[model samples]
Target chain A: MRATTIHAPGDIRVSEVPDPTITAPTDAIVKVTAGCICGSDLWPYRGENPITEGDTIGHECVGVVEEVGSEVHSFKPGDFVVVPFCHSDNTCAHCLHGAHSVCTNLGMTVSGQAEYALVTQAEGSLVKLDEMPDASMIPSLLALSDVMPTGWHAAVCAGVPEGGTVVVVGDGAVGLCGVLAASVMGAEKVIVMSRHEPRQRIATAFGATHVVAARGREGAAEVKEITDGVGADAVLECVGTDAAMGTAFAVARPGSMVGFVGVPHGVQLPVQKMFQKNVGLRGGMAPVRRYLPELLDLVTSGSIEPGLVFDSTLPLDQVADGYRAMDERRAIKVMLDLQG
Target chain B: MRATTIHAPGDIRVSEVPDPTITAPTDAIVKVTAGCICGSDLWPYRGENPITEGDTIGHECVGVVEEVGSEVHSFKPGDFVVVPFCHSDNTCAHCLHGAHSVCTNLGMTVSGQAEYALVTQAEGSLVKLDEMPDASMIPSLLALSDVMPTGWHAAVCAGVPEGGTVVVVGDGAVGLCGVLAASVMGAEKVIVMSRHEPRQRIATAFGATHVVAARGREGAAEVKEITDGVGADAVLECVGTDAAMGTAFAVARPGSMVGFVGVPHGVQLPVQKMFQKNVGLRGGMAPVRRYLPELLDLVTSGSIEPGLVFDSTLPLDQVADGYRAMDERRAIKVMLDLQG
Candidate 1:
């Protein structure tokens, strides 16, 4: 089985790896149909995060069930399924509160960008599609595995009200998906802060009413101007950098909250500003598993087209190129065609 | 008129000062019947907060309307009123969102412990009682101006669910009031982290189901043990110190939020922990004016006795002693009897 592995910074390769086997009673094997690169994956590729040589990477996938352990009752061979990046029992106290990311029996669905991926907590981690779908539906369904639900978490935490204005910081795939989430939630004005033209186009298509192309202080000022100095009703901080966090708080209206989904890296929150403005901070690792069911329905029902975030698609052998394209910002999201 | 003044960290005096006159069309004068020292006031009295020499202090009071500027219509002479510590129009965009503290035209109610105090934004800052009440009601109504509403803010931000467990991180007047608030909101278990026996008694009276006399790490361990390791459903961070904030987050359940109302002073938030736990931080200065009506009704209707938090009552001339008692922790709260 061909899988994506990282040797070091700037080194992503597709190499033959051993096929996955059910390792536990609750495990299931997934023959991945398609998987995509996430902005978060860039951390290791850029050497910002330590990574071991030859370690398989990837945590998002849509696939056909190849096999299952005896305890896996919800899924079986030949079924199409979407896998949450993190697996959970979905019955723990945390999961019951829709915080599956913090579930007591949590497991990571790693090595997903491959021919075969082993999934633990199969019944709770994998969402079985009602029927096998055509090629076109796979991309959007695959999105439900991580980005879509993560974006939805940001919107939910920000408490984006209907007919309210929202400012989305960052223009990566997740940020673009955040725009789509805000739109689907009925946000009247989805203001996006993006300096990139290609990402801006996707943002507009996803329901951004305005775009602030400037970065840093000027960008926040622009948003403030657009909002008539009242600041945004809510802010979606999709980038985890300090500047992005600063902009998110700067543009948040009094009593509004900043829904942060980006994995924070050296980000120092402006706590005093948040207190004074009554702007709250909520969101961490998204409970994507809990949100997968609803988002899967939306994608399958054609009410949303989150798959448009994927600007580049390649064969499984070109997984290295996918990582490079994503790292170079040449692609918003790079989908690896694992079936090939 | 004589008002409490702060000359330095340990120096407080009630000195003769010029009577306040209508400085704005929105101003009103009140003859204070009762005013109480707040825990926050101890910040400057203890020299933690910067204070100017002979600066007038005090922000909580219940009084009879003495005079009103032409534009002050909501309150009039002879009517008893509870004045929020901060004044606002209550008609600004922020105020309409129930965030009076962020009102566009906000002002502070200084010199509140004096015989007569001038209030700005009278229509928005002063809540008139239906009628004058006996001396017994003065202390409780005075509590509404700050402590009660501030505590309520903490509970509201924490989203205290009915029948849920709530942990209050302070034993001060505000934290005691927080126990009262969590009780009124129907929390099944209200836990207070208080080592002081007197404050613990007040907490019990206000509806604390359990009292964790331990502080720091041990206190958190006790709370975890009490909750069977699940943690509290909501946490009210009534103390602004980093240690208190640490405990608030340490014992908060996943998907819970920490409501903070103590004015943050050099408190660095544990942002990483907040994200990892799926716990949220919300709340700042309490919008006491917006909550005044509901709390006023609760106090006037004889449903809660927050006034019991005041352990010592002193005459107006003894304002300095009131500050000293509070600074020494000899009194939970000190009431200045202005009518004397």
Candidate 2:
């Protein structure tokens, strides 16, 4: 089997690797059908986060259950499924409360970026589709594996409501998808803060009523101006930079929520300002496991095609080019076809 | 009228001042019946927060309406009432959403530790009791003016649930009151981190199931062990210090909530850790205006007595001693009697 490995920063390479097998009773062997380069993956790829040499790299995927251990239940051979980013027992108090991202048993059961990955707590982490999805539904189904549900969680965490003003801070696939989610959730005004013309247009197409190109304080001021000085009812901080976090905090009105999805880099929460303004912050990794079903239904019903975020696609062997394109800002998201 | 003014960091003096008249159509002048020192007041008194010399102090008071403005509808002359620390019109969208603490109309009204306090947005910021209470209920009613509701909001923001374990991170009157609120809200285990004997006993009486005297990581470890390594489901941060904030974050289970009511003093939030842990931070000055009615009901029905926090009382002429007692840690809270 061939897998992508990062020897160091800027040193991603495709190399032959031993196939993964079930190491735990709750583990399942999954043959990756499709995978993609996630924005979070770049955190390690760019060396911003520590990554060991030859570490397995992806956490988003649609796969087929090739085999399952004795303890695995609710899944079987030849089943098509979407794997949540975090593996959980599905029975812990936290998982029961629908916070699967912080699952207690988060061992590397399965990773989406590889051709074959071991999935832990198979019954709890795998969401089997009613049937094998049609070829046309591949992109959207793959999205449900992470991006769509993540965007949805960001919107949900921010408490975006019907007819409320929501500000999305980022132009990446997840941020663009948040615009769609806010719209689906009935926000009357979804503003995407993006300077890139192409991404801004995509944001508008995804139901952003307004677009502000400013960054930090300037961006927040723009949002306030649009909202008559009350700031946004909710803010989705899709980018984890300090500037993006500051903008999110500045733009939220008192008693409003800020949902942060970006893997925080080096951001410090402005606690004093946040408390004084009565602003609340709730968010972390996308609880994709909890939101996949509803988002999948939306995708199947044709109300949204979030897979549009994939501006380019490549064969699994060409994953390096995909990374380069994204790092260079040439693509919003790079979809990889494992079966190709 | 007499007002308590801060002449310096450690100097509080009761001085005769011009009587306040209705400055806005929504304002009302109240003859203060009682006022108390708040934990927040210590911020400037301790020289941690800068304040201008001769600045009027205090934000908690219970009083009788002396005069009502033409636009004041809910309050009239001679009505006994509890004034919300924040003066809000209650007509703005933020207020309608129950964020009276961030009301758009009021510009940060204060001046509570005085002979008379002017309340703006009388209809929204003043809560009237069914009748004038006997002198015994004064301390409890005064608690409702700030500390009691603030503590309740801390628990509420932390999302304390029935049978859940809650940890309170302060030992001041508000933190002590949080123990009572947590028990009242049905939390089976309320852990209070206190080393002070009086406060520890008060916390136990108020229903703290566990008490840990350690601070920082050691304290968090103790709390974690008590909850079977899952940490507390909710943490109430009633002390606005870096150490208290750290304890709140350290002792919280992943995906749990932390409600911090203490005005932040040099506390910084580590967003990276917070994001990975999936913790949520919510709190501000308790929207006492929102919780006062329900708490007053509990008081009127004899269900709870929050007055236990006031360990000392003084006449209005001895207001300077009240400040000194609180500042010197000789008293948890000092109530000022106007009639004396």
Residues B168-243 of candidate 1 have per-residue lDDT tens digits of 9999999999999999999999999999999999999999999999988899999999998889999999989888
Relative to the unseen true structure, what is the C-alpha lDDT of residue A180 in candidate 2, on a scale of 0 to 100?
A: 91
Give the per-residue lDDT of model 1 (tens digit) for A1-340. 8888889998988888888887799899998999888899999999999999998999999899999999888888999999999898888888988888988888887788888888888887888987898899888998998999989999999999999999999999899999999999999999999989999999999999999999888998999899888888989999999989999999998888999999999999787887888889999988988888789889888999999999999998888888888888888999988766
lDDT of 2 by residue, A29-148 (tens): 889898888887788778899988887677778889999999887899999988777777778867777778878886543356678877887888888877888888888888887788
Q: In model 2, what is chain B's TM-score?
A: 0.97
Tell me the lDDT of candidate 1: 0.91
> For every model in order, what is the number of clashing pairs?
0, 3
Candidate 2, overall lDDT?
A: 0.86
TM-score of 2: 0.95
Q: After superposition, how far is residue A224 of candidate 1 from its true place, in Å?
A: 1.9
Off by over 4 Å in 1: none
DockQ of each: 0.78, 0.73
Best prediction by TM-score: 1
